[model samples]
Every structure is written in structure tokens, then in C-alpha cells.
Target: MSRTELLRLVFAQIFLHATMTGLRLAAPLLALSKGYSAGAVGALIALFALSQIFLAIPAGKYADHHGVRRPMGFAVLAAAVALVLATAFPTIPVLCLGAMLTGAAAGITVIVLQRHIGRAATSNAQRKQFFSWLAIAPAISNFIGPFGAGLIIDHAGQASGDLLAYRICFAVLAVLPLLTWLLVMRVRELPFEPYDPKAAPTHAWDLLKSANFRYILFVNWLQSASWDIHSFLVPILGYERGLSASTIGTILGAFALAAALIRMALPVIAARYSEKRVIAASCIITVGVFAIYPMVSHAAEMVVCAIVLGASLGCVQPMVMSLLTQVTPAHRQGEALGIRLMFINASSFLMPMVAGSFGALIGVGAVFWVVASIVAVGTPVVGKIQLRDNEMPPEKNL
Candidate 1:
């Protein structure tokens, strides 16, 4: 594909992801407006991740067998329908259902897109650069989606409950996926190459059984959990601190903006440090950031934390993608990406519910401390990651 074609695909992914981020930030506040407790809100978040956990591998398999075009089209359309559902119902149950549909759609779309990019790249350098650029779309979308949602909610005076402002947000979000669907239609479809039965690794479990791949998956899970917790807890934390919806959205947006800025510089950073070292350092910094996140009561303080956290976490995705593609066979890239997502989404599915309960009983502050402890404990595991070959070039003086 030409660079223009790739960019168009990336833009569609951006819109779809923005919709997901907007919903993620808005859902809890919407539920809270309806008098739901923290625990119930957590369940709502779990429902989203739960659906992805179940469908991820299957979605990957479909992509591997049928190619990405059809799956991408379906996923975007499903997301559009999901946003419309949430807009129409404006209830906790319906919103939960919408979350599931959105998650499933996102899971499929992500694996397919990653596989598409992995296949298109001609070298490790290009792969790193491509995936880093790919990561930026979501980072940018994360900023636009949540920040926009918060602005809409605050301006429309609908932060309190099931109100017109929230519905309007959903309505606007629905347009993004529809546009993605149109873009997917315009892109030339790649021909599908059926998975060869004679291939060494026929099953997803076979890849999971490899010690190196398992370690990568575990590291991904830890990072994924941290991402989930930050998204899930920050809004609630902001609400508790008496921050407005707009301020909370901007804080989250700042985090995402920092992430985007770091991602754009990842190629330069990878030139200086090994992907393994970068990832390990990021986890350690993340532990420190989480330790301080709970204590901050002011919006400005939270934005500072968000920037630090975003920069640290932002270094992770491109490295992981670079490493994952290096470790896995070319033909099975789709399945491997799917399995990786399954592990992450499984954590996403479980952690929010646990955190929610803890938040309900103990406090949201305790939740942050627990997340910090978990990341700290996992740092050594990140240190142990031994890729068979270093994909990045040796450090060069700037």
C-alpha cells in the first residue's frame, strides 16, 4: 500500500479508537449520575473488556483466514451501531451492552490493523517506525475523544445524569465509525492467504506455550493493566477531588498528548537504548507515578502526573509491537497479536472489577497504591525479557 493508503487506514483507526476512549471516560460518569456505586461502574468497565477477551482470538483467526478488509469493515460498523445503541438507550445496562460491542469491534480492528502494518513493513527499522506511528493515532484519539466528551458534558450541563448532552456526545461519536466504514470501503482490499495447515504453530496455545513469547505476553499484560487502571480510575479520582468533567478530560488528554509526543520520538530513543531497557525503565517509572497519583487533589498536579505517566507508558507499545513481530513467525502475526490482546483484555476484564470493589470498600487512593505495588513487583520480570535477536540498531550519537 502507498503511504497515503496507510494513512487513511490509520485515520479510520483513530476515529474508532477515539470513540472507544470517549465512551470509556463518559460511561462511569454517566452511571454515577444514575446513582450507581463505584463497584457497579467497575462492572460496566469489565463488561467491555470481557467481550474482547472472548472474541480476540477468534477475530484474529478470521483476519488470518479471510484477510483484514472484511473484518475491518464489520468491526467499524459494529462500533457505529454500538454508539447509536448507547445514545438511544441512555441506561446502564444498554451502555454496558454497547461497551461489549465496542470492545469486540475494537479487538478485531486492532489485530487486523497491526497485522496489516506488520506485513507491509520491509525491515525492523520500518516496523518500529510504522508501529510507533500507529500508536500515535490512538494517543491522539485518546486526547480528542475524552477532551471533547468532557467539553460537551460540561457545556451542555449534563454531567449529572442521563441527559441530552451525553446522548449528543454518543451521537457525535457514532459519526466517526461511519466515516471509518466509508474509508475502509475505499481502501483496496488485500487478497487473503489461507493459513497453511502444515505450519509449525497451528494453534494459538502453541505460541503461548513458548517461554519467550509467554514472557512478552506477560509484560504486555502488566502494561495493559496499567493502561486500563489509569483510564478507569482517573475520572473517578478527578470526580472525588471535585474536578469538573472538562478538567478531568483535559488531564487525560494531557496524558495522551504526552504519549503521542513520546511516541513520535521513539525511533530516536530506540537508537540510544535497547527496547528491553526502555520497557524496563518505563515500568519502574510507572510504579513511581502511580504511587503519587492518588495523593494529588488538584487538577494541575494530576496533569503533571499524567504527563509523567504518559511519557513512561508511551515508550512501551512500539517496543512491544517491535518485539512481538520479531519473536513470532510472519504467517501467524495476526493470531499472535490477537492472543497478546486476549491476555491484556483479560486483565482489563478482571482488574477494573477488583479495583472498583476495592474503591467502594477501601478508597480510590488505595487502588492506586495497589497498582503501584503490582507494577513494582513486575519490574524484574520486564528486566528478564530476552529477545533472541536485537531488532533496533546500535546507539548513534545525535
Candidate 2:
């Protein structure tokens, strides 16, 4: 595929991912307004991750057989349906269903698009650059989605559980996927050899048997857990420090901005360092961030922590993608990506509950300390990831 085509795909992904992020932010607040308990709200969030966990591998396999565009089209349609369901019904059951649909759509979109990028690149340098560019979409969308939803919700009057504003947010989100669907239709498909059923299929479990891949998967999980914890805990910590909602939002926004900036510079950084070394350094820095998070009493200090944490966490995804693609066979890239998603979705699904419970039982500071301890333990393992000498080709600009 041409660079122009790859960029179009990236833009589509940004919109689709933004829609999912907006819905995730809007769903729980909407649920609470409808008299749902905190547990119920958490369940609504988990439902999305659960759907992704179950659908990820199958969707990857399907994309491997068919093509990325077909799955991409289906994912956008599903996201559109999800937003419509939320807007039209505005009830708990409908919202729950919509969340599940959106989650599945996001999971399918990610696996296929990732596979497409992996296949489109002919060399490791291109893969690193492409994946680095691709990772920025989610970072950018994470900020756009929640901030936009909040602005709409505030304007619509959130004081009385104003349903109109929430619906408006969903309506806006609905249009994004529709636009993406149209874009997907116009973009030319990248060349991929269709999967032949006559050939034996590879099982996901078999992929886990490789020690290097297994280690890479473990590192990916840790990185994902770090992201989830940072997002989940920052607001609570800020609130405890008596920061207003807007201030807390700014802190998180700064983190996201730092992530995007770092991703933009990742290719240059990767050019000078090995993926293992970069990832290991990130893990170490993340450990420090968590350890310092508990001690930050001022909003400015929180922003500082956020920037460091975000930059460190931002280095993880593309490196993991680069390493995973290098270790896996070309024919099974989709499946490998699927397994990676399954692990990530599963972590995302379960970690919030665990973090919340730990916070409740041991206090928020203890939660951060625990996460820091875990990362500290894993630092050596991250440093020890062994790849073949040829895994990373010489760096070149795209």
C-alpha cells in the first residue's frame, strides 16, 4: 500500500477509536444518571472489554482470510449502530448492548488495521515508522473523545441528568464512523494473499509456546496495565488533593499530549535504541512515576508526573508491535495480533475492578505503591527480552 493509503487508514482509525472512547466516557455517566449503582456502571465498562476479548481472535482470523477493508467496513458499521442504539434508546439495556457492540467493533478494527500495516511494510524500518504513526491516533483520540463529550454534556446541562446532551454526544459520535465507513469504501485495498482453508490453521496457544513471543506478550500486558491504572487513578488522586474537575482533566490531558508528542518522536528514538532497551527504560520510568504519584499533592506536580508517565507509557505500544511482528511468522500476523489484543482486552477488562478494590481496601496510595512494586519486579524481565540480530533492520525514514 502507498503511504497516502496508509495515512487514510490511520485517519479512519482515529475517528473510530475516538467514537469508542467518547462512548466509554459517556456510558457510565449516563448510567449513573439513570439510577444505576457504581457496580452497575463498572459492569457496563467491563461489558465492552469482554466483547473485545471474545471477538478479537475470531475477527483477526476472519481478516486474515478475507481482507482488512471488509472487517474495517463492518467495524465502522457496528460502531455506527452502537451510537444509534445509545442515542435512540437511552436506556441501560440498550446502552449496555451498544457498549458491547462498540467494543467488538474497536477490537476488530484494531486487529485488522494492525495486520494491514504489518503486511504493508516491506522492511523493519518502515514497520517501526508506520506503527509509531499509527499509535498516535489513539493518543490523540483519547483526548478528543472525552473532552468533546464533556463539552457537549456540559452545554446540554448535566446538572439534572440531562439526557439530551448525552444523546447529542452519541449523535456526534455516530457520524464519525459513518464518515469513516465512506472513507474505507474509497480507499484502495492493500495486497494480501487470502487465507486458504486447505492449509492447516495455527492455534493461538501454539503461538504462546515461543519463549520470546511469550515474554513480549507479558511485557505488553504490563504496559497495558500501566496505562489503565494511570487513567483510572489520576482523577481519584487529583480529587483527593482537592483539585477541581477541570484541573484534573487538564492533568490527564497533559499526560495524553505528552504521549502524542513522544509518539511523534519515536522513530528517531527507536533509530538509536533497541526495542528491548527502550521498553525496559519505559518500565523503569513507569515504576518511578507510580512511586511518585502517591506523594504529589499539587496539581502542577501531578502534571509533571503525568507527563513523565505518559511519555514512558507511550513508548510501549509501537515497540511491542515491532517486536511481536518480528517474532511471529508473516502468515499468522493477524492471529498474533489477535492474541495480543485478547491479552490487552482481558487486562483492560479486569484491571479496573482490581484497582478499584485495592484502592477501597488499602487506600489509593497503596494502589499506586502496589503497581510500582509490580513494575519494579518486572524491570529485569523486560530488560532480558532476547531477539535475533536481524529482527530490527537498519533505520530509514519513510
Candidate 3:
């Protein structure tokens, strides 16, 4: 893929990812508005990640066998049907179904896209650059999906939180995946590795047996948890400090903007540093931010913390992705990527509930202190992960 095509693919990812995020936001809001309890809302939200946890490996294997365009075609169909069904019905059951479908659809397409882009480059540094560029999509879309859906819900109808308003958000989200299809449907397919009759297939879990792959996966999960905790805890903390919803939104937005800006700069400079060094440094910075976060009473101080934490976590994804392609086999890269996604989605689903439980039992600040402490303890292993030279011939910019 040329730089132009790579960029178009990035936009394609943004549309698909945003559709899932928007629906995730819309579904929970609609459920809460209909007088559902907090526990019900949480259950509805958990459905968003349930399918991805179960299907990620299969989706990755499908991408490995079929390459980019085909898996994406199936995902696009699924997302469109899912979101369109939600728009037509806008009921709790429909939203539950939509949540699962859209989540799986987005996860499948993202795995394929990541597999394709990460392979497009010949060198480790070049893969780092490619992934750094690709990493910006989520940062951008995380903001776009929920913010756009919220805007539409607040202003698109005669009353806020009405059925018509949510339907409109669902309708708009349904169109996003179609736009993703338009961007990539005609793009050329990269060559996939042919199956060997004698060589047996490897399970995705087998990748975890490698010391380096385990280190990468663990470090990736560590940094990702920092990002998630910041997102999950900040609003609760801010609310306790008596900040309004808009103020909390602004604080989170500041973090997203900081993350995106840092990512935008990473592609040009990623070759200068080792992936482990970045991960280690990010962990340290994150620990510092989480330590001081509870003391931040003012919104401005919280925004500063948000930006610093975002900048730190923002650099981890591309570095981890760069490490992944180098650490894993060429043929099983998709499976490896799938395993990574599964771990991530699993954490994303389980962490909040655990944190909520712990938060209620102890306090929210203890949750941050606990995760930060674990990340700090694990930082030393970064130096121990070993790398080996790839035997595959240098790939062209596929």
C-alpha cells in the first residue's frame, strides 16, 4: 500500500471504530433513560465486549487465511445490519444485540487492518511507523463516536433522551460502516501465506508460550489498563469534586487530544527508541500521574494530569505493535494479533466491574493506587524480553 492508500485505510478504520463506540454510548444511555438500574446498564455495556472476547481468535484466523478485503467485507455487512436494526427498533433487546454485533464487527475489521498495515513494511522501524500512523485512528474515533452521538441525542430531536433522538444517532452510526466499505472495498488484497500440508496449525494461546510474546502482551495490557483507569475513574473523581458533566467531558477530551497529538508525532520518530524503553518510561509516567490524581481538586489541574497521562499511554500501542510483528512468526501474525485483541477486550470488559466493586468496597483512589502499583512492579521485566532476527525475506510496501 502506498502512503495514500494507508491513509485512506486509516479513515476507513476511524469510521468503523466510531460506529461501534457511538452505538456503545447510545445503547447504555437509552437503557438508563428507560429507568433501567445501574446494574442493568452495566450488563448492557458488558455485551459490547462479550462477543469480541469469544470471536477474536477466529476473526484473526479468518484474516490470516483471507487477508484484508474479505474479512472487512463480512465485517461491514455485520456492522451495517447491526446498527440499522438498532435504528429501526431502538429497544433494549435490539440495542443488546446491536452492541454485540457492532463490537465484534469493529474488532474483526481492526484486527485485519492491523495485520495488513503491520505487514506492509519491510523493517521493524518501518512497521513501527506504520502502526504509529494507524494508532491515531482510535484516538480520533473514541472522541468522534461518543461526542457525535451525544450531540445528536441532545440536539437532533424535540427532547433529550427521547426514542427519536436515539434512533437518529443509531441511523447515523449505521451509515459509518457503509462509509468504511466505500473507502476500502476496491483496495488491492495483499498476498496471504499458503497453508503447509505437513506443518500443523498453531493455537493462538501457543503464542503466549514465547517469553518475548508474553512480555509484550503483558506490557501492552499494563499500559492499556492505565488508559482505561484514567477514563473510568476521572469522571467519578470529578463528580465527587463537584464538577459538572461538561467539565468532566472537557477533561477527558483534553486527554484524548493529547494522546492523538503524541501519536501523530510518533511515526516520524519511532525508529529512534526501543519499544521496551518506551513502555517502561510510559509505565513510570503513568504511575506518577495516578499517584497525584486523587489530589487534583480543580478542573485545570486534572486536565494537566490527563494530558500527561495520555501522552504517556499514547506511545505504547505502536511500540507494542512494532514489537508484536517482530516477535511472532510471519504466518501466524494474525493469530498473534487476535490474541492481543482478546486480552485487551477481556481487560476492558472485566476491569470496570472489578474496579466498581472495589471502589464501592474501599474507594476509587485505592483502585488507581492498586493498578499503578502493579504496573510499577512489572516495569522491570521490560529489560528481560529478548528478540530474534526474522528469517522471512524483506517484504515490499505491500
Candidate 4:
């Protein structure tokens, strides 16, 4: 990628991810405005993943058969349309439709972007660096997006005029995809070998047979579940704990900032530890931080723990991304990532609502305790992953 192209990619990623985070922060607020119960909020989140799980493989295959640029453009346009539809007609059913469309579009965009990064980088170090930069997108979004949404919602109280706030948020988001469509327009396509039907696996199912891949994929799922509990549960839990809306927002912002900082140091950290050790150790640290959550009393101490949690957990994805490139062949990249993401999305999609229901039934404190327990399960499984037959060990950079 040229310097100009790289800049464009970075800018586009920032905008796109910020938009996604803004929308996520707004979703539950919007649903509750329409009189949605807690269960309904869970349903709204779950509906987004229904299409994501079902369509992931085909979306990846489409990108692999074609090029990432076109599918990515289409996904962006689709996301814009979904946002418009969501804002124009705010109902449970319409919300579901919008969420489903956006999720499906996201599924395609992710594989294509990962493939683009994979092909763009010239070495393992570059790949890790590229992913480290890519991590900034979500980091910024997570930090800024919720606060932005909260500002919007606060400006237009959730019960009365908040619809306009959401509408404005969605409108701001549309500009991102439009800009991404323009930015990627000038970049040269990475040359790919023809997708011969005979040479390609007959079904995406074949990708699942690798035990190493399966273990990593499950780790991805388990990790996502733990993270989602924090994402979807924190606001609700904060509210229940008598935290003011602004305090809740500040707590989330602090956590997100910590996560962003952790991601920034990932390339350095990955340079020192083998990818496997990084992931395994990170999981252990995350589990430890989460385990301490239930014992915290002071708000500042809670915020500190959130920071530690974010720092530990935020490093996993990039390390996992680096590992995936080593474990899957070039031609099969989309399929492997798509399958892994399917389970990741599945866990992200379900775990929140499950936690929410449990919170409602038992207590809010139980949510963190449960999530900590779930995260702990990944520690033993992290060591089970190995690179593919033709793969090489990570280059020693530390």
C-alpha cells in the first residue's frame, strides 16, 4: 500500500469503527425509548447476529472469489441504508431488520479488510504492525463512541426527543462509509489467483476439521463472550448500582481508554512473547482482573480494575489475528477467518442477553462473577493451538 493509501485506510477504518461503536451505544437506548423491556434489548442484540452467523461463509467466499474492494463498498452502502431504515421507522421489527442487515454487511467487511491487511503486509513484523494500527480503529470508537452517544441522548432526553439524537448519530455514521467508499476507490487491487472450483474445498465445512483452528476459534468465542458481558452489561449494571448516567459513561470511557493503550503496546508485547504465550498470558491476566471485580467497593478502585481488565483483554484479538495468518493458507484466509468469526459473533451475540437475564433473575453482581468464570475456562485451552503444516514460527523481534 502506498503512503497515501495507507493513510486513507487508516482514516476510513477510524470513521467506520467509530460509527459502529456509536450505533452500538445507541441501540439499547433507542430500544428502551420505544418501550422495549430488558428482554427486548437482548433480542435486539441477538437479532443482529442471526444473519451474521448464517451468512459469514458465503460473504467470505464472495470476497475471495471477487476482490475485497467491491464487497466492502457494497457492505458500506448497505450499512448506510440500514441506518436510515433504523432511524426512519423505529420499531422492534424494523430495528431487527436494520441490525440484521448491518451485521451481515459487517461480516463481509471484516474478512475483506483482514485479507487486505494480510496481503498488504510483507512480513510477520509488518503484519503485526499493520494489525496493531488496525486495532486503533476499535480503540478510538470504544473510547469516543459511547460518550458521543451519551452526549446525544443527554441532549435529547431518552423519553421525549431522543429519536432525533439517534437520527443524528446514524446520519453522522453514514458519512464514514461514504468516505470509505471514496478512499478505497483509488487503491490498486491485490492480485489473486483464480478461484478454481476443483481446487477449492467443496464446502466451508472442511475448514472446521482442523483441531488447532477449532481450539483457537473457541478461544475467540470465549474471549468475546467475556468482553460482551462487559460491553452490554456495564451500562445496565452501573445504572442498577446507583451510578449516574454520566458516571457510568465515565467508567466506560476509562475502560476503553485503557484498552486503546493496551492495543497500542501490543506490537511491542508481541515482539517479546511468542504469539501463543501472549494470548495465554493475556487471558490469565484478564481472568484475574475480572475475578477481582466482585470484591471492589470504591468507584475509583472499580475504575482501576476496569482499566486492568481492558489492558489485558484488548491484546488478544491482534495476537489472534497474527496467529490466524500463520495457521491458515493464503487462499483459505477468508474461509478460516469467517469460520472463526462465526463462533466469535455467536458468543458476542448470545452471551450478553444471557448475562442480562441472569442479572435480572439473580443480581447484577453475579454478571461479573459469571463472566470471570467464563474467561478462566480459556486459559487451559489456549495452549492447544499450533500453526499449520507449512507455517513458520513467529520471527524473533524482541
- Return the TM-score for each candidate structure: 0.78, 0.89, 0.92, 0.83
Between candidates 1 and 2, the TM-score winner: 2
Which portions of model 4 show Cα errors greater than 4 Å?
2-4, 25-31, 34-38, 86-93, 143-169, 195-201, 232-248, 356-377, 388-398
Q: Positional deviation of 342 in candidate 2, in angstroms? A: 1.3
Q: Which sections of candidate 2 miss by over 4 Å?
A: 153-167, 186-199, 239-244, 360-362, 389-398
lDDT of each: 0.81, 0.84, 0.86, 0.72
C-alpha lDDT of candidate 2 relative to the true structure: 0.84
Model 3 agreement with the true structure over 166-226: per-residue lDDT tens digits: 8888999999999999998867777897656686876777777777788888898998777
Candidate 3 off by > 4 Å: 159-161, 194-199, 388-398
Q: Which tens-of-lDDT digit does each residue in 1-398 have in candidate 2? A: 67788778788888888899999999999888878899899889888788988888888778877776788888988999989988898899988898888889888888888888877777777777788888888877877888888888988765545888888888999998987776677766665558677987667677777777788888888889999988998888888989999999899888888989999899788777778888999998999999989997999999999999989999999989888887776656788899999999888877877999999999999999999999888777776666665453221200
lDDT of 1 by residue, 1-398 (tens): 67787888788788888888888888889999889999899788777678888888888878877776788878887888888998898888889888888878877878988888877777766777777777777777867888888887887765554488889888988898887787777776555567677855567777766566777787877787887889889999999999999999899888878888998898688766767888899988899999999888899999999999989988898889878877776656778888888888778667777788989998999999988998888788866656645352121200
> Per-residue CA lDDT of candidate 4, range 3-120, in tens?
5666667666666655566666678778887777998887776766688788888777776677767788878887788777766766567767777776776667677777778767
* Candidate 4 pairs with clashing backbones: none
Q: What is the C-alpha RMSD of each candidate to the true structure, in Å?
A: 5.8, 4.1, 3.4, 4.6
Q: State the number of backbone clashes in model 4.
A: 0
